[model samples]
Target chain A: MIWQFDLFILVLLVITALVALKVRDLLSAAMIFSIYSLLMCLLWAEMGAVDVAFTEAAVGAGLSTVFLIATILRTTRRTTD
Target chain B: MSDVLTFIISRFNYWIYIVLMMIGLYAMIAKRNYVKKFIGMSIFQTAIILFYVSTGVKSGATIPILEHGHDIGHAAAAINPDHYANPLPHVLMLTAIVVGVATLGVALAVVQKVHDQYETIEEPEILFKLGQE
Candidate 1:
């Protein structure tokens, strides 16, 4: 894998991870976490793990995001702490 | 200076994964909301998957599929394993990705039920309610 591209994706992954955890809005955090998953999918694809990337894109970015948003809507949108 | 740069560049993926794992752990431990904890758990699982997949990478290698394996005669030729990326971690991670999502969905469903029971998803509130009852 190209270290330059790897570094770029990794940096964004970290940023999105932190934001996902720190965000007060649960829906926003879920969306940011989906972005994190997409970045991870890109990194895996770059490293030639195509099947793994495809699974991540479909499961991590797609289904999990839908599940999280559904849960947030059914429950609460804001976090207490 | 070049040695330091090379060292850092060569192993940066591992270091970054470790950092991501720690972030996930912190979220799991410190967050008050159940959904936040669930998110942290997903982050932690993804970081571990990243590390495993990175370990399977080889320089100048193609995907794991054998180019000429479909041909009977070509299959007899000695193929160098170094030409292809490792498939083990990718396969393992595919299972892990599915398991992670399954757990996430279950955990969130439980969290919703908890919200229904306690009228809140906060750990402290739930605990306090439980203590009173």
Candidate 2:
């Protein structure tokens, strides 16, 4: 059961990375990156590192996402092909 | 059937982490957008943190705090030493988190300055503008 959950989270991480790469909009990529970080935090928790997971959840998903979004807003909306 | 599956699953987390880290690195290298690069960098750093934390996991281990009314010798035996988590990874993560935040702050500030000067955020546009000047 637990192993299945680990596999699920691992899959989610891979899918998120692919989505981040394929997305054209910078904002969308940043959001997918945030989701990737959240999945990683859950993975860490499953590995029995609660403290590290907590920090990753906060810093990776929360602060980093906000920072990237702000930068994207300041920049151009459309990415050149 | 179940035992073999569990054994493989238990050992595969680290490999998954490495793959994610590599993907992040590739994105950071191949992407042209500055903000996207920063996001990629964050992903890469987070992957490393995951790897470090996973190493500290041990089965049935209690927290590192000394138990109430227990001497060192008794506490050592009563607690399952084999399962105790390594404190070093946790400590290292704290520092990594702080550094990640600081780097993000500085990177964003630079991005803002670039936008202010170039009037455009796209890297190619900024380069073109600079060349024309």
Candidate 3:
């Protein structure tokens, strides 16, 4: 079992997710979210769910990030807490 | 002591997913920004998808596809059910991923409109603006 690799990815995913949530800059948050998505894709691939991993990599890492950046461009970049 | 460690390691994946889900839930409930909440919602959906896929896992199974030189239906008799991975969750999650992207697009459109109308994406300020107007 490659459980150690899975655990390592999970740790990074959680850390990236938390940072994406806690960061003040919307741009950084969006960038971090893409990283989170790629990490998730890697986890799924590691589990042999290649289809799910492909979709996650395509949409989560690609399309969603572009959509977010586009929307961010249309509005202000600073976020109020 | 080793038993405790073994148990934790064996079940760590599920627990990690739970922790991820909780993080998403907390963001949805307590976050102030619409975009932030949207991000949280994506995270929440991802956790659910991951959970479903995990349930379909079978040790020692190959990908759920016909082996080489095996024509569909003709090779069905020789193939053992346990040899192939579960395909149901994989198929279901394909649709879910599309839905997620479509929903994200709609939500972002709403966010844009909200910003255009009120000049703010923060809830309290938007509420204040609405009240003022």
DockQ, all models? 0.86, 0.51, 0.66
By TM-score, the better pick of 1 and 3 is 1
Which candidate's DockQ is highest? 1
Top candidate on lDDT is: 1
- Write the residue-wise lDDT of candidate 3 on A19-44 in tens digits: 98888899899999999999999888
Interface root-mean-square deviation, each candidate: 0.8, 2.4, 1.3
State TM-scores per candidate: 0.94, 0.83, 0.92
- Sorting all predicted structures by lDDT, with the top scorer first, yields 1, 3, 2
In candidate 2, position A51 carries an lDDT of: 76
Chain B TM-score against the true chain B, candidate 1: 0.89
Runs of candidate 3 exceeding 4 Å displacement: B1-9, B69-76
Give each model's whole-structure lDDT. 0.92, 0.78, 0.87
**Residue B99 accuracy (lDDT) in model 1:** 96
Q: On residues A1-81, what C-alpha lDDT tens digit does candidate 1 reach at each position?
A: 788888999999999999998889999999999999999999999999999999999999999999999999998898876
CA lDDT of B3 in candidate 2? 100
Pick the winner on lDDT between candidates 1 and 2. 1
Worst 10 residues of 2 chain B by lDDT: B61-70
lDDT for each residue of candidate 1 in B8-110, tens digit (9 for 90 to 100): 8778888999999999999999999999999999999999999999889999998888887878685747788899999998999899999999999999999
